[model samples]
Target: MLDFAIFAVTFVIILVGAVLYLYPSSRSASGIPGLNPTEEKDGNLQDIVNRGSLHEFLASLHGQFGPVASFWFGGRPVVSLGSVDQLRQHINPNRTTDSFETMLKSLLGYQSGTGGGATEAVMRKKLYESAVNNTLEKNFPMLLKLVEELVGKWQSFPKDQHTPLCAHLLGLAMKAVTQLALGDRFRNDAEVIGFRKNHEAIWSEIGKGYLDGSMEKSSIRKEHYESALAEMETVLMSVAKDRKGQRSQTAFVDTLLQSNLTERQVMEDSMVFTLAGCVITANLCIWAVHFLSTSEEVQEKLHQELEDVLGSEPVSLDKIPQLRYFQQVLNETVRTAKLTPIAARLQENEGKVDQHIIPKETLVIYALGVVLQDADTWSRPYKFDPDRFTEDSARKSFSLLGFSGNQACPELRFAYTVATVVLSTVVRQLKLHQVKGQVVEARSELVSTPKDDTWITVSRRS
Candidate 1:
């Protein structure tokens, strides 16, 4: 009778699992009227993967289901918010916190059971900002040297020869960010290469967060992933140990060591900064060069600006703030590229947007895909015009979701300084032109990048 009972229970468990898999609910978890985000075919996650990029997928859903939609990612329900109004409504009005960090935390598996989570988050952000500022200050000389090396390489290339800017830019950014963020952890060229490999292993898997059960599926990938993470922590902990009392303006690890966060916390934060610092910065550099290659008028205007304020002078941080057109170029590039595409938050309590209820713990994603190109916010939404970012126009365009304002990604802000150095150093020396008949296509990875190589021909300016 006991054997029969055990067998019966096992059979029932399997039957329920089958039922749930075969017939997932299309309704809201709370069963509230108007609360349900519009569902695709059978409310399954296959639609997302079918749509190609997360950006493309979100746009398709938003087009069909209005500004807000519901989709499942391997049985997890997520609400996609595509409109600026929806974002304003969902995010705190005062802008105390943001969804970018939430999405990052989700990706990193950050769980702080400590109370005052918001306060802790803010504190950590300040710490990161402080580290970036110090690191940039000390590393500016090194950064310019790297930029010079890139310039020399470009100038060496025969005229009309195509250069793969993405790969070159990634190498440059990898060098700059690692030197700045990791400090003594990567002491030599060989050590940095090893770190870069391990970092890429970890960084690449971050995108796989969207791919369900992928990390566990491959033994080789799993081993590499584990080894990369462990190696990073080991290097970081050693640096942290060495630099406990000593502080260096160039060392992010030193700043982290001085922080109140635990060694593990510091390691995690370093990993986040190291990866985030390099990838998006490389993307920005690639696009900036691409746009300049395509637009001679903008290039000439930027060249003129550089000539006026920065003629043959050492590029410095103070000079960075004075370059208004340069700032506008960056703004336009970020708007057009949508560099960091999506950010999300969790609803702590029940809320409503235009009579539709959002139940507690709902995954609220800010797509930023459609909204950046929204006609109401941007004139000639498809065109790249830096002039549209005048002081009056700038105020209205202030709240770009992924990489702008007080709410912007901190790494983006850090990248901006380094990127400016790159742009200034390069443009001052070289005139960039598009490779004839070369087409650059932007695709979304963890960082949105050129699907094909971004080819540019550089000629030394007379």
Candidate 2:
């Protein structure tokens, strides 16, 4: 769902900057309260940078301006909604269109099938979402096998050995997503390693490029980014070509290919899924473990639930929903971490969010980080209490924030299921512990992650 983080906010500014407009200096056209442009072209760009991240900026912006707020992006009007009421007014939970698909494609520079009619667009969206589910469902055993391989490695580690949580999970996620999306070819360690290198290069470059406008100014950086993108695309294209006219398990590429989507469409979707799926899945696991490591009560509760639900059995797809408290732990972890702190959608037409009048084509930001931790909505908002999600209202609030139910992005849905399996498998057998004297603070960026590489240790449970 938050697949938009790497490029959405910065992409909006760059896209709007190309077609300049002069917004009023004193107040927004929508009559919402916000910062005026610091410069004619920059708008409140410097303000966002000074605040460190768009998520951080929106938190402070809402704190001062209330639920509905506005800001200028390169002289264009941008509105941000920070409360549940404001979010419901702006985004319907049942909306068919997927906002992240648009933003992610724009950032990836993949324009295939973009000009299709609404029917075609909706068809493709359904195909993408279904493909994710199909991949996970059909490849459930492979998912378990891949995760178990990682767990096995950890099992062999010495009791005092501290693991590099982020790095390890990233590798596991890459293996899982690539193998499941692109098919069995990714089972080869060399193939997965090469793809990971290119993926990391492209991902890092894109994040840095959008943040500082480096891609435009530094020819070398641009060249590197393009080279990595080209290499990755080449790999995806090869896989897509091979999948053509071949009968196989309904993996992501196969589903897209079997449909009416063009070859370019298949390749674009494959690359997008691979990139977005791996990062989100990895970070979700990272935070889930990080939180579990610090709280023994939470861990014990989760372990007890796992015991009651599975009782010496490994996690299977059917048994997942039965692990209710485990789900709550993951949900609360997502809330506390504010993973994917912000998401955005463009206003299709003039709309009203509360009393504010949003204009057509306006860039609307969902200040999810602000809403997720709002005290009025969640009791002791900053506290990581999974029990808070036991109520039906918490689930509804979470869905409204686009982190649950049908409203969740395909990436998030995929991550949730994957995390369910991994956590159920690992935590069922090992007791996770936080590294002594180590502090992990979240760095709110494209994906929220620990400010540094987090280290954790695990001991075999008796």
Q: Which candidate is the best by TM-score?
A: 2
Worst 10 residues of 2 by lDDT: 1-10
Write down the lDDT of every candidate, Cα atoms only. Answer: 0.69, 0.81
- Give the range of the ten consecutive residues with the poorest summed lDDT in model 1: 1-10
Q: Give the TM-score of candidate 2.
A: 0.94
Candidate 2 residue 360 C-alpha distance from true site, Å = 2.3
Clash number for candidate 2: 0
Instruction: Give the poorly placed runs of model 1, Cα more than 4 Å off.
Output: 1-43, 74-76, 93-102, 112-115, 184-187, 247-249, 391-395, 398-402
Largest lDDT belongs to which candidate? Answer: 2
What CA root-mean-square deviation does each model show from the true structure? 7.8, 2.3
Q: Over the stretch 59-80, how does candidate 2's per-residue lDDT look in tens digits?
A: 9989998998888777677788
Check candidate 1 and list the clashing pairs.
none
Residue-by-residue lDDT tens digits, candidate 1, 428-462? 87888988878777776456778877889888888
- How high is each candidate's TM-score? 0.87, 0.94
